[model samples]
Target: MIISCYNEEHTILQVIDEVSAVLPQAHIAVFDNNSTDSSKSLVLGRIQMLANSANIDGGGGTYQSFIESSAPESKNKVPKTQDFAAKINVESKRAESKRLDSASLDSPANDTTLFNATSITPTSINPASIIPTSINSVSTIMPNGGRLSLFSTTTQGKGAVIADAFALLDADIYVMIDGDTQYDTAFLPQALAHFCQNQLDMLNIARATINDSVHRKGHSFGNKLLSTAAAIFFGKNFGDMLSGYRIFSRAFVKSFPAQSKGFEIETELSVFALQQNLRVDEIEAPYKSRPEGSFSKLHTFRDGFRILFMIFQLLFTERPLLVFGFLSVLSFAVSLIIGVDIFMEFLETSRVARFPTLFVCVGLGVIGVVLGVAGMLAHLVVKGSKEARRMAYLNHKKIL
Candidate 1:
């Protein structure tokens, strides 16, 4: 599993814990996209804590439950929404807490119980509850499934982070989830089950229910609008175009050409699958609100327009004949309208009075023909590229 995160210190650990719980056998890697807060430290500490437990237990199966049980109460609580002032106050507290001496943090690594003297909880650590029920209970974690690695980059885009992660890890299957906990991890097993059983190339987790305020509602509507447009253009209806939860097979991942550097990556992913004619499917998952103090990185209007622009771009690139042919037809119709008026005026007056209008009509007609011819040429180029991609994909080994 690959997690892409920003300044999500408030909710990152809980999200990882949940992923670890639901998919015990899955290897998890987190890509921290230049976070300034305690996000990196908290994630690293939790990972260290888990690693310590696994080493002591000899196997991960028995150690995971202990980590879950000992998690702080704040990790489970749904905090009340706070205003900017309250958010700033909370951040200040977080900064102060993160300033703890690194010497002390590393000191517990040698001890049996890492959290015994430290406040490692995300929101507010309760020092009293850190006592060991045995040395085994308070052990630190590093992550023990396949291998755990936390990669940090100074980059600022989700697509770049994911691209880097893909290049770094070699796996049969890849699952991506937003660092902020929005979709429940409990549904992950079912999502993966389909891909494995059906030999599918891509599986997108569609949000069956979005539980948030007006902004979320608007986002849902925008997603539907974009999905509808995509369905029309691509001939495949992706249930949700903006959902961050997705699973991809090795072929799909390796063959994919990722270009978007922002939220539009989701749209690009779906379009790439459609263009490649890959086996793709979707599973319904419940969407929950972001944890309090954790916010979204997407600019709705900006990203929404970007998504729409991507769709149009794919349309022209994939089906240039259809898109530009329509534009050409529309231009031709406008020129015909202007030409008819000019003809009537000249017939009545027995002279050509509107020379500029005649020139404008002629220009429109020429542009219409030029666009139509260009679209045809582009269509041929796109077809050739599609054939090349399809042949390459066929030569690649299938994950299933």
Candidate 2:
């Protein structure tokens, strides 16, 4: 388990405790991006690692840059690697020549293939923020790649970064949530057990219904509106569309090409599956709002627009014709209205209406037909792409 969140000091321990209770065998890992709170201390029994989350040193005199940067490499520069740890690998044949091989004739030992922690991007939390959990030993986290993205005006820190952290972990399942304690940890087992029981590709926990008192007004209401919009647009609905808690099978995570860089990642995840025609399922879970002590880090307008952008993106990506065809129908309706008005005027005195309603109608009708045809062409392309992705995923996971 890789948790990418900040200011999680107060309830992070509880979250960890809940996860550990059910998934005892799992090697839970908390990647600290340098928290300024007691969050590090909250990691109960999990293995702790600190990656290079930077902080400006010396206020006035020395403000230099302090972040490692990286992007997906080109084929020539570096072939695409599905194996996460293979980037730093060295051939065993060379190790034998170096006499690094066990003289006692032991099997080829791992020499160059040690997990160089420097490659994984650090979660950005202030080091001064953590109240340092009492621990005798913890692996030193040396971050590997990519700095926090500064291009986007996002206050929602590291949503995509944390999602990438899970991606790099290269696990059989990927779970996600916000740092604030709004989700019920008690139902975690039910979530995991259901995933395992049916061997599903992905499982989303719908945080739909909650005790009224426990849910906040603004956040709750906004969630309902966006969810309703998403359901109507997609012709499918999950009880809770903005759910921060979900578990995904390895294949889904590996195949998913996440494009959103903020809170919209959640919406993107759900839309991606439906768009790709993946077998996505959901289970009901308790949803509780956070305490006043900690405020929500969501940017209402920015993320709302982002989610809207994602929805349209999926619409374009999935079926361009249907989306555009709906517009075409509206366009044709306007033409029909104008034509009826012209007919009424002609009936009165066998004369045309003062307005050039006939010309306007023809123009609208012609434009609408063109747009509808364009949409149909786009629809064909999107459907073909989705099928290709489905087959690719099945081949990768050996499902077929």
Candidate 3:
């Protein structure tokens, strides 16, 4: 499923077509997150065309099976009529059946056949009553033998869109990519192979090589810094923590608590997997900039801060001891600095003159000890919660 937002009107169709060509067996979904441009219309048109083609192909099989199965019963004919008049009536019936068969071929009856059905009564096929004249009626559309859905939404946020997708879609492997043509569909086979062959829960496609000059330097630098921070806290080596191209097993997608509402979705996903101790792997894939006139929606500094904040948030929530322990160490160090100055003053002079410094030292030391103890207690709570979460994840059936 590809979650698209504003202003990808130029490359949206290309992305859809290319992904379909590469993964012919894959069902493609396009979620239009309320684009102001003609993106929704363009995608809806192309997807409908794809659906029609699939329907024609699948409906042909269905129609053929109907003919073959019914042919067997019609082959041994025992005419009930005993006169020439009845013979003429039989001939008329044949003509009517032939006319109906021809009409079925031209009618949108095949449009309702959702798959290449091996068993279907010829009598039940009905032509589509109303041809879709606009996108408003597209909600009733269903492609034959293949699944393709186009949805329109008014909300923003990439993570929110993806969470909705995970809830709505039931697939063995759920894949997500940026709607813009940054990631190539050519590497999909290799990316999927890792999950199939190994014990992998999530596969993140890293943009190892930046092929286009459109990628800003700040974006690259921020990614490296954030990746480093994530590694330090989460203990997982991620090449591109910000990469939008990712694949998740059905279990992971179903159990993941996606709380992020914005671009920090990628970070949240990675952290969730790590927190659960799920097997995660990464593939270094090439990144291409969008086609001419297409632009990125990311605010580097703004999103970077959000990503950083999430890293710390997860660090505290998932590994409270480490974060709070570090705070405790810092506080103790400050207290020691003040205490040492007080000690030096007493050593140089006959009496200690700084009463405020003494109080400040005592206060910081007490805070440090209190935080350290709180961290220890919180770690136990976090441990029990993690155990429960792991059990819940394990109880869910594995998607094969």
The lDDT values for all models are: 0.68, 0.54, 0.65
Q: What is candidate 2's lDDT per residue for 1-400, written digit by digit as tens?
A: 5555566676666665565555542334454445567665554222221221212112221111111113332222321122211122222332222110000101122322222222121122122221111112132212221111111112344555555454445445556655566777678667877877887776888875567876557666777887777777775677677777888766777677777666777787777777666677898887776766666657777777777787788777666887899889988988888788788878988987566677898889998898899888888887787777777677656231
Worst 10 residues of 1 by lDDT: 81-90
Which one wins by lDDT: 1 or 3? 1
Q: Tens digit of lDDT per residue, candidate 3, span 299-332?
A: 9999999999988888888899998899999999
The candidates, ranked best first by lDDT, are: 1, 3, 2
* Regions of candidate 2 where Cα sits further than 4 Å from its true position: 29-159, 208-210, 288-292, 299-302, 340-356, 398-400
TM-score of 3: 0.75
Ranking by TM-score: 3, 1, 2
- Note the residue pairs that clash in candidate 3: none
Cand. 2 Cα-lDDT: 0.54
TM-score of 1: 0.74
TM-score for all models, in order of appearance: 0.74, 0.65, 0.75
Instruction: State the displacement of the C-alpha of residue 127, model 1, in Å, after optimal TM-score superposition.
Output: 38
